[model samples]
Target chain A: MTATLNIGFARASLETKLFFRQRDAVIFTFSFPIILLVLFGSIFEGDLEGTGITVAQLYSAGLIGAGVMGVAFQNLAIGIAIDRDDGTLKRLAGTPMPRAAYFVGKLVSSLVLAVIEVALLLAVAVLLFDLELPTDPGRWATLVWVLTLGLAGAALLGIAVSSLPRNAKSAAAVVSMPYVLLQFISGVYIPFTELPSWLNDVAAIFPLKWMCQGLRSVFLGDAGAALELTGSYELPKVALVLGLWLVGGLVLCLATFRWTNRGEG
Target chain B: MTTAIHVRGLTKRYGEVHAVGGLDLDIRTGEVFAILGPNGAGKSTTVEILEGYRKRDAGEVSVLGVDPGQATSAWRARVGIVLQTANDAAELTVRETVRHFARYYPNSKDPDEVIATVGLSEKAGARIRQLSGGQRRRVDVALGIVGRPELVFLDEPTTGFDPEARRQFWDLIRSLAAEGTTIVLTTHYLDEAEALADRVAVIAKGRIVAEGTPHTLGGRATASARVTWADGYAETDTPTALVRTLAEKYDGEIPGLQIVRPSLEDIYLDLIGDAE
Candidate 1:
């Protein structure tokens, strides 16, 4: 067990170095969502009619959710699929390195990237938009759990969706299509109440929606609760639902994901 | 003699096409064994099965005395494989890739020494993607041997090499064999098998059609020879008598005198061709 952990850490360190060196991945996952924050936050600056917060503040929270998904879901799924197509995963499968260690290493790296993505987003949010950083210790604590659970769910969803791309060539398109659709219903653009009831129901089933809501609570305090599709912020439900997605997505990923594109016998 | 690998009645199929039919093989320790076959002749499948990378349909197999299908992590540490495909760690340099793989084994060879062994010391810091095909292949070999494995598999290791690179790779394999590592080689190049294997097995349609030393497959070493002179050439059962007769025809040293036997390639073609 200790050996596996040690190896997993080493693999994570190496992978993180590799991930940063990829300029496209860095620009796409880390910087892309921040760019969206600057674009949308500037364009729509005033307070909405129903909510007490300005558009920039609400967007800062929402884009953080999108950023985490980019790293843990979009980048990870495409990277893993490319590894499968290029035979890196197949080669590693023949090694003494525990297979579980690879997934753990992936989770660790995605979390690390998630932290950096969030940090950059927060710095920009505070500096340019004059966005308020979560002040209370409880809000800070809420931020931590939301980020953790959100990253876990995204990682699981990444692994589950990775099996859908037939090869590396199609990985980006396959992973991003659902991500884009989820953003539409989950309030990266339109707020949840403004969305259709069925669309809101569909978005509620995913961790991304709850993640955006959870972060919105940290940034908006008591006022953001009224904006939720539910009457209040429901932090406990956020935790429980994200936890369920974590477990369920992990089960589905493990059932379907393979190191190779080989057909079943 | 100690045996490094043994197989009995191994069978595999992809739907209806039998990748490997009933096949049996034994590779002794400290010997370089080669599995030579045409493309799609099941060489890669059999090797993958032994490497524990694929499941066999029906087989009684033991690799280093453990069933490959149920191989443990420790078992994995004791075996090294250079796959048919090139190493795909393009983001990493040669040194980093080798050192990364070295962490997997309890008694791995020094990464630097392993890199030098495969003659990549000069390009140690170069990115794998920046190197040429032959140079990248050296990285693959470096990774494979870093574990100091008891047995090694080289699957068509020189498939994309220039002639000079191929000879250099042959030298590397020879040095490893000299160190008493049991090696399993698969290649379409008949000369590669003839150059390195202590014993060679020829498989066709997923069955071993012949197995012997390179010089003697299909009774080649002792087969009928051809005697030729400036005037004419004749295939004869006894080349020695023909040479003597040719000497008499010249009444002295025969001009352009030669005796030739069927090359290993000739015998290999006949074996596979006859099977078809």
Candidate 2:
């Protein structure tokens, strides 16, 4: 078991290194969020309505969730597709290392990268946009749990969605499509109050809305809490929803993941 | 007395196509066994089933006393596999790849020693993407044996190798067999099989059509022998009788006379044809 754990860690580190080494991926992962934060901060410098919080704070929380989703879901799905196409995953399947270890390694790497991205985004928000840290320790704890659960949900969703991409090139478009639509409806790019009523109703069914709402409760308090459909900051229920999505995502992944590229054109 | 591989009535179907159809084989410990056939003749499917990569639809298959379908970590660690295509770890050097794979096994050989044994000592520090095809093949070999496995599977390990590199690879396989490792190899190269395998099985259409030692496969040894001289040649069941006639015709020493039986390639092609 110890040896297996070491192998898992080694594989995870190697994967993380590969991710960071790619110039475009690194720029998109680390630098993209910062760019969004700057753009949103400049656009909404003063006088934002609907919710009591400033536009910068609302956008900051939303951008953090978006960045985490990008790393944990979009990056991972594309990576797994490429690895499958290149025969890396199939070769590893023949080794003594367990299949679970390979996925666990990927999860670890994605979570670690997500945490780093969140930290950088928050730092930029505080220094440039004059954002304040949450004063309540319990609220900060809630934020951490929200991020953790969101990461788990996104990672599993990535693996599940990767099966749609038959080749490495198609993987990018496949994984990014849902994310783009989710961004539009879940208030990542636009304020939730500004969206159409029907689209907002549909967005409520997605895990992203709950994640963004949960994050808002931590960072923006009661005004943001009122925006949640539940009308209460129920951290435990949010955890349960994310947990269900994680389990559902894993089942989807197992059912659809392909081990060989032989039959795929 | 122990058998390294025991496969009975193995069957695998890929939807409408049958990849392996009721194949049976027994490979003894410490013997180099080769499976030879044309492309898409179920050679790869058989190897994959034995390596525990693909599941079988039916049949009992065992490798080193454990069922391959139910293979465990300990079972996997004891078996080494060199697949047909080399997986790329472009950022990693040859030595790094070997060492990384070593960590997967419970009892692994030294990475540096394995690299040297595969004749890649100088190329150890070279990144995987920078190495030539033969050098990359050497890396694959290094990774396969780094676990110090008792049984090794080489799936066309020398597919892209040049003549000299192929010969060197043959020697390396021979040395491994000498060290008491049971090797199961699949190759299209008849000379490679003849050089390394103690016994060869010819498969066609998902079944073994012929199995025997290299020299005696498919009645090759007892098949018609061609007695040739500088001028002409004659084929007969009794080469000794033909040679005697040639000797008498030439008055003692037959001029440039030589007797030849069917080569392994000829017999293999005949066996495949017969199966068809």
lDDT tens per residue, model 2, A21-125: 676888877998789889988887773456657778888889898988999889989888888887687777777887777888899999889989999999998
Measured against the true structure, the TM-scores of the candidates, in listed sequence, are 0.98, 0.92
Candidate 2: stretches off by over 4 Å: A1-3, A43-45, A50-52, A222-236, A254-258, A261-265, B240-244, B247-259
Interface RMSD measured for model 2: 2.7
- Residue lDDT tens for model 1, B7-125: 99999999899999999999999999999989889888888899998899998999999999998989999999887775577989999999999999999999999999999999999
Task: Encode model 2's per-residue lDDT on B1-276: one tens digit a residue.
Answer: 799999999999988899899999999999999999999899999999999888899999999999888989889889998877746577788887888888888889999999999889998888788888878777877888899999999999888789998998899999999999999999999999999999999999999999999988999888998888999888889989888877888889888888888999999999999888
lDDT, candidate 1, A155-245, per-residue tens: 9999889899988899989999999888888898877778879998999999999999899899988977777767688899999999999
- Measured against the native two-chain assembly using Cα atoms, what DockQ does each of the candidate structures obtain, in the order listed? 0.68, 0.49
lDDT for position B68 in model 2:
88
Best by lDDT: 1
TM-score: which candidate is best?
1
